[model samples]
Target: MGQDAFMEPFSNLFCDLQCKIYFLLVGVCSALKLTVPPHTIHGIEGQPLHLTVNYNFNTTASEVQIIWLFERPQTNPKYLLGSVNQTVVPDLEYQHKFTLIPPNASLMINPLHISDEGNYIVKVNVRGNGTIAASQKIQVAVDVPVTKPIVHTEPSSGVVEYVGNMTLKCTVGKGTRVVYQWMKNGKRLHAGPNYTFSSNNATLLILPVVKEDIGNYSCLVSNPVSAMESEIIVPTIYYGPYGLRVKSDKGLKIGAVFTVDIGEAILFDCSADSNPPNTYSWIQRADNTTHVIKYGPHLEVLSDKVAQKTIDYMCRAFNNVTGKRDETHFTVIVTSVGLEKLAQKGKSLSSLAVITGISLLLILVMAFLFLWKRYQPYKVIQQKLQSRPETDYRKAQTFAGHESASDDFGIYEFVAIPDLAGGSRVSSQSVPGSDFISGQDMLSTVYEVIQHIPAQQQQDHQQ
Candidate 1:
């Protein structure tokens, strides 16, 4: 019974081994019937190249062997290198040109040349139960010519004249054995006298560019098999307003000196040739004070604000980039009214004295004329009376006297008169004298007689 048990365990072990061998045979047959395609490799001339080989093996093998072969057009294939398991064996001719890294089934070629362009085949063999073999091929191409190049400048546009340095660069797509050349207006430029090329021949530099240097520039790229030229590029430079001019703010002033009222304001604009606009300042020489009023192309000043009768004003223009400046000066004269006042003063005094004298003389003349006119009428009447001497005084008196007392009597008295023979002459009552009359006694008696005579004559005639 103990022997049977030991034999039973051995029998199970033997069956397991036989089954494992059967599966291995099936895997080897399957691997030998199929193959994995290889991948393509690409690289530029003078650059590193890497190639890969791909495959699969279904075998129960402890080790596998791989071989690499290289062939060019119109040439027979030759062994380049081989790798057994993890060990490598490279052909003597290609030992230094090619490298094989184990377990990856890949190859690397350093400093590849155009001549190295060809198809490479990798083969793999399995050494177990039944032998299996597979192979893959990859094609490689090399480029020895550079692609088109591009050129660029620092500043894009609006460059002023005569300024500073400028830099330009040239670059290529991809190439082997490449060379660069810089050209301006179809002429080749060299590194000398303010012109410089970069160490790698990829850049061109110009120091203190002037108006003469303005033109189209290009970068030329060349390789063994091809050459290319880049588009033109331009660099900008900024400069100056070398000569500046000054005038009134309106425009070119006709007169070099501007005349203005004392209490008015004036503006002066300064213009010049420059990349950026120039700065302006107004300077006035009055009371020995000098300072900046404002900054720009225009400067303003209030003339009346200045104390001096005659003042000098200057306009200055400056460019910060060019470190240059210019100036212009003008004079202003102020007038006074002193002379006009003096002339008017004499005329005013003379007019006042003439008016006063004429007024007094006119008053005296008017008084004398009024007095003579008043007395003239009375004198003329007296002359008329004296000329009429034929009129009797008594008859005139009777004609001018009152009527007889028999007419009517008021609360008054009357005297009777006789006939013309004068036997009993009636006496007439005398009118009483007014209070305004005052005279001597003799004059009073004459006045009484005069007053009674007219009445008495009338009464005598009536009788």
Candidate 2:
């Protein structure tokens, strides 16, 4: 009895294995085969849905049958429609919804709804070889079309650079499984140091606004069925007064210096790159003092009205919202450029070249005059006399006693002084023969007779 029980268990196991082998052979040798591409299919609400299936049989069949079933998760399959040869029979509840044409295993659903979204099972049965069957399952998903998205900013008015934060949120009216994307000037944007996004990528946050963050922004929402983009929106970002400069209408500008012609009216415009247009001020600096001369962007100055040859001016730009300021300094030189310009008309030689030549000529003349004056005999004598020491002046005064007589023996200048007796006397430390003469006669001597004395006779007298 024990050996019989063991044999009985082995027999049951052999039978079970034979049954499994029989079924496997049947599945492999079956003439009918069914193929359904794209196991998962997506469908839009209110749109026609098609589930495609292809079937083939090797043997010619007297009758062909195609059956379709619908099932949800953890639910029993429900019959949708079936076709025998060329005749279609649909379930009474879904007669108008499901459609299937002749001998084909594919099924169609018109105006598919959310409730119709489920797994679809198609079966093909051939009646020639005692009902050879093949089946395939396809999953269907229903979604509403993605609507156009709209973006809204936290502060609609504006935000200041580096002082305020900004937020952008995207919203959709109707959609399922919608994805969000941020775009700036037609390019996709990603999270950065100051930029962040929500989990669903619908909201964008700018921690601190800056000048580089200003641009046209938009939202793109898409689903498996449709895609849409919102209208462009520009966020106002108050920025600084950058690249400040001054421009003149009528002047020759070289770097920061503007050369203006005499009697010409020059208009200066102060400008800068900024948001919320900057307030401008024109300031004039002279004699180490500065004062605002104008409040507008434009300043008109006549060259004749300027008293100085060169004047310093400043252009200041201030942004009230951003609380930033920038300034530029320039110089205006008044010259007789009007006449020079007139002379330059239709002439190959520019006025600048003429001015340069004249300047060089003047400098040469001045140098020549300085050298000539430095080496002149008269100037040399004057400089020597003025630079003499005090003791030298005392020695010169003692020339009447013949002290330092050799030093005073060079050329001498003569002068006459009127005396109290109404006659003129020769003023000098000493004369060659003056000691032998009395006072009235000596004083009466003519300047011509004294000057006519020969150098030989003077030397002889000196010896």
TM-score of each prediction: 0.32, 0.68
Provide the global lDDT of candidate 1 against the true structure.
0.65
Residue 52 Cα positional deviation in candidate 2, in Å, after optimal superposition: 2.1
Query: Clashing residue pairs, candidate 2?
Result: none
Local distance difference test scores for all models:
0.65, 0.78
lDDT of 1 by residue, 322-411 (tens): 676787777765434333233433433577788998999999999989998777655654564455443233433444443533332221
| Top model number, lDDT | 2
How good is model 2 by TM-score?
0.68
Candidate 1 off by > 4 Å:
1-167, 175-192, 198-201, 208-241, 247-267, 273-279, 301-311, 317-463
Model 2 worst lDDT window (10 residues): 441-450
Pairs in clash, predicted candidate 1: 241-273, 416-426, 417-426, 418-424, 418-425, 418-426
| Candidate 2 lDDT, 412-442, residue by residue in tens | 4344456799766666545554443334432
Candidate 1 TM-score versus the reference? 0.32
